[model samples]
Target: MTNRVYVVGVGLTKFEKPGRRADWDYPAMALESGTKALADAGIAYDKVEQAYAGYCYGDSCSGHRAVYGLGMTGIPVFNVNSNCSTGSSAMFLAAQAIRSGMADCTLAIGFEKMQPGSLGSTFDDREPPMQRHLLAMAELREIAFPPAPWMFGAAGLEHNEKYGSTPEHFVKIAAKNHRHSVHNPYAQFQDDYTEDQIKADKMVYAAAGLTRPMCSPTSDGSGAAILASERFVEDNDLAGQAIEIVGQSLVTDLPGTLDSASLITLVGADMSRTAAQRVYEQAQLGPEDIDVIELHDCFAPNELLTYEALGLAGEGEAHKLVDAGDTTYGGRWVVNPSGGLISKGHPLGATGLAQTAELTWQLRGLADKRQVAGAKVALAHNIGLGGSVVVTAYRPAER
Candidate 1:
């Protein structure tokens, strides 16, 4: 990085099932989270030299509408949409602004008010963005269930077949995250579903025996993070609480992404793997150095597969880690203490920033009930299926 970037403040609104809260527009969600983030940073909106707003399902300049509620500061407000990686991608831009000496302070905010149920393409009139991905899956298996669940579930099934992982292993991940959610105020589902309950819930993908608990719920929420340069943090006396973003990388689909030969690749494991490798390389740290993680657990299977992708576990050995209880507290790494997307709710645009907020708290020792003891190094992974993946490493800033 040309300059160091530090996250001085982060904020989130409670995630809720879409439409469950009436008149809860994205604008209001944006205002609430944005205000809280500014307050946490001890700065005003005018201090932000630029802003990036991320949302997947919105009209043009939705970013302007959202940030105007914070202030009509007339900073360069850019709208970003990169599927589910939208939030982190926005953060990527803000961090770059600071890294390149273009800005001292910047804001990246994300908000989503999604329709309930499985996700689908917004435009039926034109070619869907995921047409190629779906075609890849088509060559491997018949498309039978909801597009989102089937895609993720098929990837899990592939892992199962290749590695002898049982449905129990996948359900176990869901159980752990749901249990974690009981302590998260922002989680949409705090029900501590047992492994048995997760296994027995109505199966969404019959082949993989994936139940509803194994999938991320569509939600309405917003999150915001403020980034500043080292000089800005020092000048503002924010080092005590700031989290240094040691390394960050955003990667999209590689050339072989559509092969579908490995359903793992079909669902973005390679993108995640490549991105994480770059992040680890830049941070001069590896999986063993990471004290905590908040990976993209959009589906329980993805969480398991991601273990290998993120280098937290060896290939075909993720189930072993789950079996040994290595993904939670008192393990090698405490992954997703925020309940993750599995229980935390996934408001597409807001999910990445929500993950960032959780890790920030963990590093700052401010995560209350979900705190990872003495968390010093944290890694965050968020991937979107048209295939954008972002991996970030963070450590506490010292005065």
Candidate 2:
């Protein structure tokens, strides 16, 4: 029998802007979440055989500080920084360790404290000063057509022009996700926005209307999960309540690949598809079998494209699904029910793990009002800068 890996517990700090008098920093948030996860799983901290902590802005040795807060056990800990995908990457590593018998139980944590500034510089380092200037010029050229402020708008323009998608199509996405967010107590922007409200908001990117609510707000938060082998689960009596990690895959973008089609059909998506397919093969299931999904919606357009990449919809058909109300809560397949990054807020490293936490809740039927009825199998997709993407498939133990 194949050794299955199960997520026994998940924990997350409420997503919010840090108050001036907040007591916890990034590491503290991570520790608190990690402790909660252990408590939730009914496991002791000393039982964790290894640890993986993901963070972006929390200075050097951030993971150490968080682990130390739980008491300095001599377990091996590795810090990971893969931009937005950090959390999932950390989980991937933990799963591998458990599968390989390197460790029976592992803890994966993601945390970040938002710093005020443009994130472009941190995403790519290969750009020379002149190349940076040229990209700026290209951005200007893009703005001339769409009149939005951010480059994501330029991406939206390309997707719209290519796929015949509309601003209103994007607005519907915002509305659907916001409606979902209202059910997520941890979501930062839970109130719904009218399509008109989204359309009338000031332009952040000519193609991407500020009214669309493109980016997640900067914030400080953390999320954590405990992964264990099937042997550990059976021995520990965690069988019926576990969330199985059936598949995990990560892919990085090729260098100097600026083809518009490449961005629309990201390499990470292909990698994730392959990964999800492998998971299905292992789990004896398929895309049509999944009941819920938590995908990266760093921007609205990204979600539309991801629908195609994840095999939920065909290319150019994603917009149609949006128009037909197919991606909503009661739709055939529900995406981003946690409000996604759009309304849930993205704290860099924390997002990937946040997606996992949301999936866990959905699988456990504990998502409160956002829960998909009778959810059995679910998927979580996350992407990092330079086009790194990780896709994971999960199933509740009851199924």
Candidate 3:
């Protein structure tokens, strides 16, 4: 547990808009990013002793096919699928392998080509007649929240009611993220949006306003990172070339134990906080020590809640932080400088890896226009269904 591991290099393909047909297959994207990561690390593919590939809906043997495309030198490749956190989980597994002396170098790759339309099917089974009926009822209720006229309900309504967050507040998130996306060449939606435009958008879900609910569009992309132990890094003279993995922590929700009455206390939020605290302890750092962050913004409200959960802001005070511009670049701490799942586009399995890639770039001082000034410590947070959570902390070599 005390062993140190570092991310030698990171690579990511551009996230595309929903419904846009991809020119490259999943494996092709994986190989492309993997090759780029290896080159970025100044290491040959043959030097990668092990590989971990994460993909939620790729065809079978996807990992082997991708690695074979790079170079047919047989290496142990394990495919992982853990919903949205697949990529971070894969990276964690790879780091563990290297730290345990099972491998000198490891490659973790994540890819996804999500289909257009709603993601309801991806959440759970829709086969059983009773289940489908229940889902339909739930969907109907979600569409009629706040007694219909108010245009809000459930989680979004509750969040607003408690924190005095208006639809305009949510629009601010969209505006800020879109602005950030202008600097991220790999982001799907680089076009900027004004608050007026965000306010005018049509609503999607009842409680969740249009400006917030439509955060994640379907995306097709891939990303990869290479990890090596500190011993391996020193032996290979990689002192000034790696982003150190200062800490990693994971937590899962207790099924059927979530507080159903209060919409704010999501099981995932608690799980994420627990993991973040553990990571901070392991890294010997506090929330103030984090210069940059990439968090799961599956929805705008999710990001707001994350601030409180991560202790970056007090309970029901996340809106104040956003209003103060503390979450933006050059602020107290930059959150989701890569445009997040909002404008960056969430490709499910690829999202966790994409977050890591952004952090790696920031820590290396290579984030270009979107870079957080003087960033030395970075954190990436990802959550999956049933409240699976992972938080990773990184420190630049200069630190």
lDDT (tens digit, per residue) of candidate 3 on 1-399: 556789998888998765475566887788878888988888888888999998877777887887777777788999888777888988988988977778879999998878775454443644531242233334433434212122123445566877787656667777878888899999988888888887677665545565433466768888999998887788877778799888898777644325244544432577778889999999999999999999987767677778888889877788888899899976899898999888999887789989989999898889999989889999999977544778999996556
lDDT of 2 at 37: 91
Candidate 2 residue pairs in backbone clash: 146-206, 147-206, 148-205, 148-206, 149-204, 149-205
Q: Candidate 1: where is the Cα deviation over 4 Å?
A: none
Worst 10 residues of 1 by lDDT: 255-264
Backbone clash pairs in model 1 (N, Cα, C under 3 Å; residues 3+ apart or in different chains), count: 0
List model 2 lDDT by residue over 47-124, tens digit each: 899999998776678888887777688999999988778899999998889988788999999888776433544446
RMSD per model, one decimal = 0.9, 3.3, 3.8
Name the runs in model 3 displaced over 4 angstroms.
18-22, 122-153, 212-214
Per-candidate count of clashing residue pairs (backbone under 3 Å):
0, 6, 1
Better of 2 and 3 by lDDT: 3
TM of each candidate vs. truth = 0.99, 0.90, 0.90
User: For each candidate, what is the lDDT?
Assistant: 0.93, 0.76, 0.77
Q: Which lDDT value does model 3 have at 141?
A: 38
Ranking by lDDT: 1, 3, 2
